[model samples]
Target: MEGLTVKRAYHQHCGLAAAMDVLGERWTLLLVRELLLGPRRYSELLADLPGLGTNLLADRLRFLVARGVVRQCGVGSAQRYAYELTDTGHGLRPVLLELTRWGLFRPELSTVDTVRPRWAFLAVEALAAGRHAEVDEDYEFRVDGEVFHLSVRAGRAHGGLGPAQPPSVVATTDAGTLLVVCAQPTALTEATHAGRLELTGTDSAVRRCTALLTPS
Candidate 1:
């Protein structure tokens, strides 16, 4: 807990308070996010969560390890190291998930997914300003993590989802791009025809996919 900090005056050394002590740092939450898939070597960490220096990474790793949030394992004779989440660290998945869902946009997403997912709550708000009233069909939206999925079928927008829900249309754009396309600028058709969007299923499937992203 050497580098850990407590910005909020909550209980200490246990439960939510303890988590905040380490995770309160903006980068720490991202660190948890970078490691969410499982284990990653230091280089991989740098790759996924770029902009973090080795010294800062070492500090975060040590802080996480000290707080029981992560563990380091030695790989082969190369003496390389990989960082992994402990059970406690794994528990932070939902925290980061909720944070992502709640609209956290790093500055890196203006044009590309890049190393960071630059998104904004305003982008989502603009897109979701008005949703189609009654959705009843099965639609898939390959949207980035920051935006919520709303499929308009029989007319009403659908609710939350599980991983089983296959996206009818998959676009490579992050939430920001998705938001931009849905709100203004590009039409789903144009994006698809232009190759920014790669349609997987039939033209009808592509149409249905577009409908999902259609602005309310």
Candidate 2:
């Protein structure tokens, strides 16, 4: 707890209050959301989280590291530093997914809101729970020119920012069409037939992936 902050404690002597003592700060949970996919370099996190000032980002990262929620690790051959969640941090996955599900019922995005193709991974993870979670498969998605991949194994989903090598299934679509599919999975077929989505793979793999995305 080297960099722990003394400010902003709820002091209510409750478990939830204690948890919030570390996470209640602004941008903390969103920062955790960014790391939910995997480790990200400082530049990557900054780029992904718009309008989070550098100084504040640095402060929040320090606090998280001190609290054992994140650890600094070297990346690639250059040994550049990247931030990744620790076991305690990974425990927040369910919390994040629940929040994602809850937020899905909110109002649609306005013109001022920003969107990233990678966020589609969160939707998939949230919606796929208990629906084919036991299936092990690799699925690639190409949305709005960016590539992402998801792997499911042992009732868990792991996602990354790039393609899945030798992917079992590949689904390509624009952002709007992808949103529609995530909201109404049955529309996937119609979207494919209408040229809004292009699904490529063997019949079985495609079927498995479709079932995985479709809610039970």
Candidate 3:
């Protein structure tokens, strides 16, 4: 109620409608998507989301904060402000994953479309579909010079914006190669063999990750 804008209220009693009332606005869900991995500073959010006007970003952040979906907190010793998802905001993870799964079949990439390494984390989660349920492992990925990590625990995947400590597996590849592997998991072996994707770790850890990435 705190962040509800009366002017745009759907005035609907249904739960889905209520959710859409808050999230259906233009660029709002994308904002949530960007925050999925972890907390981000204002500048970081702006950089990741190109073309979203600064004023609109500010307004949306304010709305989300007031709605209790996100909160602002001190980040690092500098104490600069960063925005993070609250428990209520994390409740949208399933929704985002579902949307990602649905979008995967929509169409091929367009020339103007942009892809970021961090997004691959969410895409992997969507693609995995709980295949990592029995897995408790840490995977570090280096995509196009960017580094990120994924940790699977208790049947869910969690990602962060940087390297993992003592990762179980380390995967190095570019965005295109990663995309290809995700689309045709069988290509994982080929990609590794061809040196398009590099995987490193103990044989057992690497095999486990390879299986997770290339599910039957």
Candidate of highest TM-score? 3
Tens-place lDDT digits, model 2, residues 1-216? 555456588889899999999899999999999998778899999998999998889989999998899999998999899999999999998888877755654334557866777676677767665454577888998988988888888777766788998799998887766655666646778788999989899998998888876543
Write candidate 1's Cα lDDT for 1-216 as tens digits. 445532454566677776566677757887876666557798878776767888887778887888788999876788678988999887765455445434533323455445333332223322332344343444434455522343445544433333225555444555455544654434556666776655565677666555545553
Pick by TM-score: 2 or 3, better one:
3
Ranking of models by TM-score: 3, 2, 1
Q: Which of 1 and 2 is ahead in TM-score?
A: 2
Off by over 4 Å in 3: 1-7, 106-108
lDDT of prediction 2: 0.81
The sequence of per-residue lDDT tens digits that candidate 3 reaches over residues 1-216 is 454444387888999989987898888999999898888999999998989999889888888888889999888999899999999999998889878755654223457877787666666667665564688889999999988888888677777778988799999998766766665647789889999999999999988787767634
lDDT of candidate 2 at residue 54, scale 0 to 100: 89
RMSD of each: 7.6, 2.7, 2.7
Q: In model 2, how large is the Cα lDDT of residue 74?
A: 90
lDDT of every model, 2 decimals: 0.56, 0.81, 0.81
Residue 65 displacement in candidate 3 (angstroms): 1.3
